[model samples]
Target: MTTTRKPGERAGLTPEIVFAAARELLAEVGIEAMSMRGVAKRLGVAPNALYAHVVSKQDLVDHLLDDVLSAVDTQVATQDPSSALQALMVDTYDVLLLHAALLPAFLVRQGARGDNARRLGDGVKTHLESASVPAERVDQAVHVLIIHTIGFAAFASHPNIDSNGYEQPPAVLRRDFTVGLKWLIFGMLDC
Candidate 1:
């Protein structure tokens, strides 16, 4: 028996392929180079051809994040939020170490409609919900956790800021941030 392949599948073009290629581009050429035109050229496809797989540059970015974040794994994240968060934090920190160009790009927000921000936000929200954290405070808690994680990654990586100033290495900053994160969260639980 013979099996048929999807139009894009045969060409090795799928949302996953788009995201993976984009991520490699992000690491190699920075976020700006991950455009549809660039990605198409990287994949050796026409610019319009990428549309069927990704809607926009923003869509590609969000999908890239989803693909990367999913690597953190649902089972581990679901087991214990605070602990899970700690693991997630460390894992993302490592990713940042490898993909320094994305430190700032990953931090950008597209407002309430932004999917990448919501991805991290919703993960923290789930943790709070499971912990029985107060509904009124869930949003706030999630905000703090997400910001702290992203900040820790940013300050941790400490990417070159327009080649003007230099900051401490991510490992050093993370040393302090990791300790501080644990202390802060532990202190909050006393409430």
Candidate 2:
């Protein structure tokens, strides 16, 4: 038996494959199961083989989060800040719906290093500044928005972690979350 390559055959893998495998695994098993060994097993690679692509579990996690962030359509991030805020929230919540467990770890992480995190953070802030949000308050508002959106989804997804955790969400829960969001938007503060 022999393995062969045509001419320029790929390694049949990339950082993306590693990340996607991790994402799907995380969605299926929660963050606690996101070990490098697990990801390697899912990818059919030996544990040591993953080192060629990811430095450590943390590096793999950071890469996995980057893949998720890339999945979010951030057009709203470039639109006018007020509506952009709402739009960003909507999209963030959408991502949270599928990957809620990944939120706790990735939400506060700016990224691995210096400007990647700072740059991403600043670009988001620029929209707030562009919208004329009081310079002092934009950070606070972003914090609240992150909390509400992720917190809401985390609470929403909590029930699905049990052995028989695959039940449908109740209509009442849907109504309450929507109404709560509405109240937060219109009835609570005079933004």
Candidate 3:
């Protein structure tokens, strides 16, 4: 006789479900405490069950990164290159801020081989090219924008700094980000 499948035993598990559960677990316990076992526990599944969808913790993090990056609005690439680039950076910063807990993991796993990452990179490259930024400087410009945005986001999300009274008000922070972005854009154009 064949045994009946339990109602909640892996029958409802999907990569999306796993990702959502993992994200919640990450937010709740942080990266150091986040693990397949924790995610499985959150989903009410055996730890081994998560491995069927995500081969390892790193793989799970990568998938979550992809999901987070996918929310970045790259459609601005069709507009003026300078504004498009700045918008992209701002959008990236917003996404990073929303997932601040995962930023450290994202930084450590630098090489994210995912479609969303590629799309963001491609949008930046296309915008730079459209702006007539010299071929030799496009890569450098892209690096500057990405690195600066990520660095700023990481810095902005530091709770200690905010608690220490070193944090700027929201308006001041936006102005500072815009000024820095304008400087980078102009520098690229002048090169």
| Per-residue C-alpha lDDT of model 1 across residues 55-91, encoded as one tens digit per residue | 7988877776655555443345357667766665666
Where in model 1 is the C-alpha error above 4 Å?
1-12, 74-84, 110-123, 159-170
Reference-based lDDT, residue 88, model 2: 61
67, model 1: CA deviation in Å?
0.9
TM-score of 3: 0.84
Model with the higher TM-score, candidate 1 or 2: 1
**Candidate 2 clash pair list:** none
lDDT of 3 by residue, 1-191 (tens): 97765433345788888899999888888777899988988887788877768789988988988888999888883568888888998999888888888777666775345899889988999999999998898888888887777777766677433556675665666666778988998889777
Ten residues in a row with the worst lDDT in model 2? 110-119
TM-score to true structure, per model = 0.72, 0.66, 0.84
Per-residue lDDT tens digits of candidate 2, residues 1-191? 88764211234667677778887787778666668889878988777767767778878777766555554555563455555655665666676667666775554563223333344355557666776667777677656555676667666666634356655464444455556665554422345
lDDT of each: 0.66, 0.62, 0.81
Give lDDT: candidate 3, residue 7.
Answer: 35
Clashing residue pair totals per candidate (backbone < 3 A): 1, 0, 0
